[model samples]
Target: MSLVVRPSPAIWVDGEPATALPIPDRGLDFGDGLFETLLVRQGQPVLLDYHLQRLQHGIEALAFPDCLPRARDHLASACKQLIGTPWAALRLTVTRGAGPRGYAPPERVVPRTIITSAPLQQDRDELSAPITLGWAEVAWSIQPRLAGIKHLNRLEQVLAANEARALGVDEVVMLDARGLVCSVSAANLFLVEDGRLLTPSLEYVGIAGTRRRLVIEQLAPALNIEVVQRDVHAAQLEQAAELFCCNAIRGLQPVSRLGEQHWQDHPVCSALHAGYREAVAC
Candidate 1:
């Protein structure tokens, strides 16, 4: 995994026309940053407001900056450059900015915002059957203070994903230190049992994914389903009627296999996928 953004792809840093960063930047030094990956369709980003709001909340929570207005302008400018492309993936990263060579941050903070857009492959399959998932032996740590923040420190995910790949699984389910279902290596989890929606409460760990929030706040109500956010243990998922993973970039991933368990065409998954697409269209 190279950190280099390709020259072919459009990239901008802090409204500047460049692709490099300072070596001493806190983002590179300490993983002190936030990022949002958004899906751009036919030039326009879907649910742009939702994505921006999450990043804004994170920026404020991290006490980084009030850079949303300029960030939005930069994003708009980047999107405009790709307006004719069929599809693109946009990534926006904001770091606490460069600082002195110590743990103490600068008294005055200047955030560094990086925006990148790259054309998406035109022929990926989104309608394929549900993907296979496996349980990762590595457990995620419980950091309630950073829960749902989407911070840049993702070594845990990198290790988990590597293990899943080595095991020939498309994705891995991660458990928190307390043996509760946290999420997939890169996305949030949702389970359906007896026509109800269930997901782990991010109060303890895991990110509050953009798509996950939208599903709870909009799609679930539109589909007339009861949504529950509470502690989810690994044993609790054993008999689930349906399971799916979600994030902004990969909208929805229906789970077809987890160890010996299997399922197909779960009505709730289909309904929610339909509702989710429609909701994003608005």
Candidate 2:
């Protein structure tokens, strides 16, 4: 799909056009930045406040220049401009600004934050039917320093995607350095076994997705299931009754097949999807 970029609410440095991001941005140079992808439904951006809060937390954690309010205002205004679109994806990016060649951050840093809106894209088959997943031989490194944060250094995900493509599957299930299943290449994974829900612990790797958090927090109570975080292995899938992956952009998705294993219609997955649809409607 062709993307259309719009002017953001505020531009701190010289106030030109927010659409024109510089080439030498630290985010591009060394992946010294963070980003959040949010779904914009109708005119209102879904879970916008949460995305902003996470962006602020990441800025503080990474010691990026302070400009959260400006970024927030710009994003709010940009969302206002995208009203009446069928569906949209708002990608908000924050960089540590242009810096020297060395690793040391610029002493006086002016953070560059950009908010762009584009039409949301979805795979018809995956959304309608269960998706097929595969095991990724590429192992995720255990790095607590960057764990749970949506940092720009995404080589692991890229490699995992390549492996999944080679395996001829829709998504890839990744294992951490310790040989425990962490998550899918792009989304958080969940398993259903004996009416209980489980997901991988993000203490070491994987991004804690906003939609995944919402599901575990708001939907688990209704299902009367304890959403426990633990390590999973490829062998453990044999015991799981249902498997799925989730993200803010695509909502909850069911994994009908993973490698040689195949799953039929699962009640838990249906209920989860129903609950998510209700949540989105509300």
Candidate 3:
């Protein structure tokens, strides 16, 4: 499929007016930036705090100047631009403005922040249905420091997504070097085994999902569900009765097929989806 190219919106670079970013921006050159894709519903940005907190955390990790206020201002402006628009997806990006031709970062960095909005997605509800999942041949490298953080460096996820598209699957479930389940190319994974909910720990792999946290916090207690974090291999997934993938944007998606492994209708995933919906509504 062709890459989706949405029109770029007005942006702010170091508290100034800009649209096209500079060529020497460290974000484009070295992927030294952080971004958050927020769900805008009813003209409100869903989980705004979570997205900003993550962005701030990522900026600190990269030792970039604090660009939260500027980013927030730009985001607010973009949301105002979409006043009559019912729904949309907003992308907020903060990059280390520009640097020399070297690995070392500049001393006084002026971060560039961009906020853009597009037509809202209709695929959010599709997660309630079953989805096809495939395994990526590209094993995810274990990076504890980078784990749980969303950064601009996502070549691994991009490649895995391509592999999934080639395999005709909705998503690709990636494994680490130790042959343990990590996550899908873009979302987190969960399996229902022996009446308990289990997911791979992000301590050594995968991104810490905002939706995942909500599921763990709200649904785990109300449903009396056990949420386990540990190593799970391909074999375990094959033997599992039900599976699902989730992200704040996508919500919860049931898994119907994983390569040749076919899963029958399972109530656990459906129940989880119902519970998650209630939580999000609340």
Candidate 4:
């Protein structure tokens, strides 16, 4: 697929076009919110159900009001505006509305939804291209309370991405404070060893990505690959036969280099890449 030039994103707040959010919005004040970045194809969100399911989990975990109906309505309206666009990136944000001057949330809560859409500047070939990774010096804090939800506080990722840019690598592998492999700066990490797929458990850190779930629950089973979720050590990557990172936006990206270790295009990675494309097409 060819990409379009970047354009100013269309913005909507609570189902209506808007320019700015209300002051004291908790999303901006305290990073108190959840957001989903999705791919839009021909005016419809790809893997919308998966995105909504994750969002629902976040809503429940955060104890926010029921926002799925409103979120769906807003998303439908936003998709209508992109009816002819071949590809676009959509971001849906849900916040606990504006709150008083402290961390303590009000007893009666109201949620706010913000949606934005912009032309997606992506080349199809780039998605499968192998890339290099560097180990980040910063480590993830183990916070089970915020482990798998895609909340708004992303300072850790920001710092790690900066480290990657300084190292001149595509991405950086992040480990938890306990010195166990977790994930990359912006995606989920996976390894292929002994003809089986291995991914780290997210009980203490890392976000459980929608694409990761798809791979474990559907794609890997279709290929008869045994999926294993357990604590992975940084040393394991050196012994793995293959390495790849995945997320909703980019799908699957194979890692070619990490320090002295390097990898070529492995068959397992290739099959999964092809399967991801087919899955998205449907």
**Predicted candidate 1 versus true structure: per-residue lDDT over 81-183, tens digit per residue:** 8777777889988898899988678999888889888887642224335878899888899987788888898999999999899989999999989999999
> What CA RMSD would candidate 4 show?
2.1
Sort every candidate by lDDT, greatest first: 4, 1, 3, 2
Better of 1 and 3 by TM-score: 1
Per-residue lDDT over 50-123 for candidate 4, one digit per residue giving the tens place of the 0 to 100 score: 99998888898888889889998999999999888878889999999988999988888788999999877564
Note the residue pairs that clash in candidate 4. none
lDDT over C-alpha atoms for residue 145 of model 1? 72
Of the pair 2 and 4, which is ahead by lDDT?
A: 4
Whole-model Cα lDDT per candidate?
0.84, 0.79, 0.79, 0.89
What RMSD does each model have against the real structure?
Answer: 3.4, 3.8, 3.2, 2.1
Worst 10 residues of 2 by lDDT: 7-16
The residue pairs found clashing in candidate 1 are none
Off by over 4 Å in 3: 1-19, 121-127, 279-282
- What is the alpha-carbon lDDT for the whole of candidate 4? 0.89
Clashes of each: 0, 0, 0, 0
TM-scores for the candidates: 0.93, 0.89, 0.89, 0.96
What is the per-residue lDDT of model 3 for residues 1-282, given as tens digits with 9 covering 90 to 100?
A: 768765455455544557677789989998988888877765567777877888877877788777788888877766676666556777788888788899788888888876666765464543466789999999888888788888888999999999999998899989998889999998888888988889998877778887777677776667898899888888989788788888877788889998789987868777767776655543
Q: Whole-model lDDT for model 3 versus the true structure?
A: 0.79
